[model samples]
Target chain A: MAKRITLPITDEDIKNLKAGDSVLLSGTILTGRDAAHKRLYELIQNGDSLPVDIKGEIIYYVGPAPAKPGYAVGPAGPTSSYRMDKYAPTLLELGLKGMIGKGARNKEVVESIVKNKCVYFAAIGGAAALIAKSIKSEEMLCYEDLGTEAIRRYTVEDFPCIVAIDSDGNNVYETEPIKYRK
Target chain B: MEIRQIKAETVTETVKKLFMDCNYFIGKDIMTALKKSFENETSPVGKSVLSQIIENDKIAANEEIPLCQDTGMAILFVEYGDKVVIEDGSFEDAVNEGVRQAYCDGYLRKSVVSDPVFDRINTKDNTPAIIHTKIVSGNSIKITAGGKGFGSENMSAIKMITPSYGIEGVKQFILDTVRTAGPNPCPPIVVGVGIGGTFERAAQLAKQATFRSIDSSNTDPRYASLERELLEEINKMGFGPAGLGGNTTALGVNIETSPTHIAGMPVAVNICCHAARHASATI
Candidate 1:
């Protein structure tokens, strides 16, 4: 039987996650990407006020297209997570419960994810339009001038994602490929 | 010279429209290659992956959605026909306007930053597209739109020298790049190789190579053979979709060659994921 989940995820709940676990995420997710992440790290390093409280929230590594009339955003989907690995440990320490992206992460980020009891989730990499459907609404939280890189709060519904790396430091890219590899 | 000026705003909107259209429409060449991927995928897992990709493309096109999440850095190749002139707006500004509208109105991600080393700030509109302009003897402008997924973009590189190395050296370089790329560029990639140009030109040709239809063959028989050989070797590495493992890794290989100085042999490989998004327009 598959595990059913609700929001307000805690570190403890995150620790229970394993690769291939199908998760239904709700609540608030903050959107960021390479540029946004670098700026966020700079703020944290400089002790500046962050746009949102980072504790126990999921952060999506994405930059979406402009929304059509009556739409919140366009073709929103995850980017490569590894590019942001440099700053991930700090976010993990800041109480981030989950990270969203496609593709694999480095060893250090994987270790940090495990240590922080955070889950690295992968939304379908290229299904931007499909993923866009999950975002019920979006509100710019910070860096509004940054446009797509702006830290926006999104309300997503049944956003389908796979657990690529679990809290135990198990990596789907490394281990799973070995089995299916000829 | 016939001179005509286009309103900057209109040019901008056109680029945006192309961005949206490219994601929704998979050209015949690409469609054919993807279908072959479905038929030739030896592993059940790989075949299933290919089918899902096909299904995803259909859903994206039918739903007018993006084929992949990394709605890449918008790259434009502009060919300025000799007799035509764009009025009011500079060529660069016109291109940027198109990028902004595509990213903003069409809801494509704006992936570019103002700077790379410091102050990595998103330009917001995915503007300042990586534009390569050429002057040709015609009275119209043509733009090629390409949205590269990040997984493949990160693996692109340029190398210098090693001519004494010849084809064997080139082959080794390709293998090395793939081995190092691992799961990063997304397996089942279409690799674009550029031979014989200045370093940057080689890079440009490599990227240009990706915009060619997947099923098209290199007119040069030598280049075509190189393409086939490289594709075979890459698959032997056992990197499957998302690097999950399978017998098939790459769907195709493309090489764009240019004449270069005898002293220089610059090579570049620009990688493109299966969700290769590109479209063409004339204005």
Candidate 2:
């Protein structure tokens, strides 16, 4: 059975996350993919204020499709998180609590995550339809100009995801594949 | 033969409809690949991911939703029957018309960029669909299209004059590409390998071959055998779903080959993650 965890997720809680554990992330998570991160990192460089207070907040690396008129957001899912590796260490330094996306991360970023008491989660890629059910509501926080790459705030209801990378530097991607490799 | 120059407006309208339907329908070949993957996946996590992909397809179909968020840059393979003539205007224009309407009506995100390097501007309309036109024998036009996203496209590669690296060389190249690709391309990817042809042609073939049904085998026995072997090897890498580590790094391996210069073993590998977005129409 896949174990589920609620959000405002603690380091200890995320540290315990294994590859197979099914996590239900419920909290005030932020959405930012490549473009927003570029801007956020620029803000860091310029010492500017972020559109949202990211301290202790989780960020989902996603570029959601355009939502229908009445919907909170469109088919929202995580984009590959590694593209932000160069900027990730900077974000981690700013009290970035968690990241939800798929795929692996660089070793340096992984170390920063461990050093900064951060976490990384994975919502099933390509399960956009099923994943959309987790969002109870959403608010466009900033970067409305970036289309799907815009920054937004989300309220999730037992949003399902998995912890792919944890603080101990025990990456599920590295360890799990070893077990399965013939 | 009915001489009908379909209005650019009409062609455009029909293409958009094709986009909407393709996103929801998981093709037969992809289905076969999933089944095979589910059966052979060694890692529990890998099996689970494949299952999720399968379930996602079902959910999209039943719920009438797009299968993946990256609905892709709409690409069209238009086969105009030699007898059928479009009277209204340019075939390309009609095709783009279709893409614009489909994307707009379906509420799919406009992901295309007019400029690749600097501007990175979203074209908003997802306009100027990539159309590859080929004329065939019949009267009706046959359209096959897919929404291709960045993750897998980023993983695509073309190599010219790679020497007789033989089977091992090819295997290493494929693995190396995946390793270098890391998580960007999206793991548990479907790799379409196109061997032979000029560099550009190889890459194009690789992309075109992606539309091939997943379970279909190459007519060449050697290539067929290699495809199976590569599939097993890729799974052994244990790249699992989203590279969180698992037995299923890839779902299947497909190879398309054509005669080429004796000295040049030009090859291309195009990666399509599990969200294999594709649909076809016979109009």
Candidate 3:
């Protein structure tokens, strides 16, 4: 059974979750992808303040298509998480609570997930149209010049995901495949 | 021989329709493969994921929206008839204009950047599509086009192996690439292996192989068998649907081969995600 949880996930929420637990996330989350992450990393390096608060936020790595009429966002699915591996540790250090994306993370990002008591969720890759239904509203927050790769805030309800890596660093990408491997 | 004068605007309109239709509608071959994989998939999670993908495709088609967000950089494989000539403009410009209109008017995302290494700026309208054109001996132009999302494309690889490396070398390289790709390219991926070509030709053939329908296999019996064997081996990896775990890692393995130099044998593997958006038209 999938656990129903709200966003701005707490450390206790992270602790109780294990790798492979199906989750339905509600409430609000931040969106950023490769270009947005690069800008955020630059700001952190130069000791500049971030445009959006990172504390207790779950960032979704996605660059959604432009919505048609009567839509919040268009066909928004998670991008590959590994692309943001270089920047994820820094965000985790700033008290980011969780991340939603597809694919595996690097060693450093996985370690940071453990250290910072963060969780990594994997939304089904390529399931963009179905996933978009969960996003109820979206507002551009920063990096609008980056276009779809801009940073935005999304209000989501019952967004489906799996805990790919939990706070203790149990990673589904490593363990689950082993079980089913012939 | 009579020249078939094709209006440049005709080409533009055809290309425009192809892009929009390919983005909005998941190919029938892919939809069927997904259904078959869903029934065969052992993992409960994999089954659920496949179900969602199936539903997503149907929704995108009915709602007339893109099946995936990446909508991909535009790619067209054109077989231009030698006896056909465009009336008003160059074939290239007409095709780019088509891509521009489809992406902008159809609401597809424009993912192309002005440069790769530095100053990567979005092309905005998704113009300057990557087009591969061949002059053939016919009066009509045949175009096979697809919107190639990069999640799986980034996992593609190519290598130059000697003739001494033989068939075993080819198999090993294909398997290694898929293993390395694992879940990253999105599971139930379509693996396109191009063998026995020069470096760049191999890569192009690999990309072309991806545009081939998953319902089909290579023409040669030996290559077709190899395709089946590779698909089996890949499924054994258990990356499954969404790569969480299961029985079906790849929906299909397509091998397209060409005769090569005596000493050099190059192989390229182009992995494509399940969306596999491709459409064809003859004009």
Candidate 4:
């Protein structure tokens, strides 16, 4: 059975989750991808004020297609999470509670997830159209020039995901595949 | 030989329709393979993910939207007939214009950047598609088009192996590449291997192999058997659907080959995600 949870996930929420557990997330989350992450990292390095608050926020790594009429977003599946590995640890250190993306994280990011009590969720990659249905509304947050890669705020309802990496550093990407290997 | 005059507008319209249709509709071969994988998948997580993917495809087709957000860089493999003459505009321009129309008017995401390293600005309409054209003997044009999302594209690899490396060398390289790609390329991935060509030709053949239908096999029997064997080995890796874990790591393995120099045997592996959007047209 999938666990239902809301956004602004707390340390207690992270603690209870385990690798490979299915989850359905609701409430609000922020969206960012490769380009957006680069900018955010730069802002952190320079100690500049961020356009959006990171404390207690969950970030979804995605660059959704433009929505057609009567749709909130278009094909909004997660992008490859590893591409943001360089910047993920920094964000996690800043109180970002969770991340929703596909694929594995590097060693540093995994260590940071443990240290910061953060969780990493994997939304089904290439399941964009279905995932988009969970996003009820979207508003551009910043970096509009990046087009689809821009940062945005999304209100989600029952967004499906799996806890790929739990706060204790248990990682599905590392452990689950071993069970099925022939 | 009579020249068949094809209007530029016809080319534009055809390309536009191809891009839009390919994005909206998941290929029948891929759908069938996914269904088979779903039935065969053992892991509960893998089964659920496959089910969601199948559902996503249906919704995209019925609603006329893209199957994935990364609608991909436009790639066209053109079999141009020597006796056919494109009127009013060059074939390249027509194709790009078609891409522009489909991306802008069809509401597809414009993912193309104007440059790679410098001034990485979005071209906005996904114009200037990557086109591979070959002049053939017939009087008609056959086009195989695919929107190649980079998630899997980034996992592709090419290598130069000597003839001494032999068949075993080829198999090892392909498997190694897939292993390295792991969960990143969005399994169950389609593995496209190109053997016995020059470095670049090998890469091109690998990409073309990906555009081939998953249900189809290589014409040569030995290569066909190689495809089957590789598929089995890859499935054993347990990458499964969305790479969480399962028995069906790869939905299909395709091998395309060409005769090469006695001294060199180059191979390339092109990985395509489960969506595997491709379509073909003849004119």
TM-score of each: 0.87, 0.93, 0.99, 0.99
In lDDT terms, how accurate is model 3?
Answer: 0.93
For B71-120, candidate 1 gives per-residue lDDT tens digits of: 77888888878776566767788777777776666656667778888777
Residue pairs in clash, model 3:
none
Candidate 1 off by > 4 Å: A1-3, A10-16, A47-50, A180-182, B1-17, B42-52, B85-94, B138-141, B149-151
TM-score, candidate 1, chain B alone: 0.94
Model 4 lDDT on a 0 to 1 scale: 0.93
Q: Give the per-residue lDDT digits (tens) of candidate 3, residues B183-219.
A: 9998889999889769989999999999999889899
Better candidate by DockQ, 2 or 4: 4
Worst 10 residues of 3 chain A by lDDT: A6-15
Candidate 4: the clashing residue pairs are none
Please give the distance, in angstroms, between residue A113's alpha carbon in candidate 1 and its true position after superposition: 2.4
lDDT of 1 at B205: 93
Q: iRMSD per model?
A: 2.6, 1.7, 0.7, 0.6
Residues A104-172 of candidate 1 have per-residue lDDT tens digits of 888889888878888988765555666777789988888877776789889887776767889888777
Clashes of each: 15, 7, 0, 0
Worst 10 residues of 1 chain B by lDDT: B43-52
lDDT of 3 by residue, A1-182 (tens): 99999877877788999999999999999999999999999999999999999899999999998899888888899999999999999999998889999998999999999998899999999989899999999999999999999999999999999999998999999988888898
- Give the per-residue lDDT digits (tens) of candidate 4, residues B57-146: 999999999999999999999999999999998999999999999998877888888989978899999987999999999899999888
Comparing 1 with 4 on lDDT, the higher-scoring candidate is 4
lDDT of 1: 0.77
Q: Chain A: TM-score in each candidate?
A: 0.94, 0.92, 0.98, 0.98
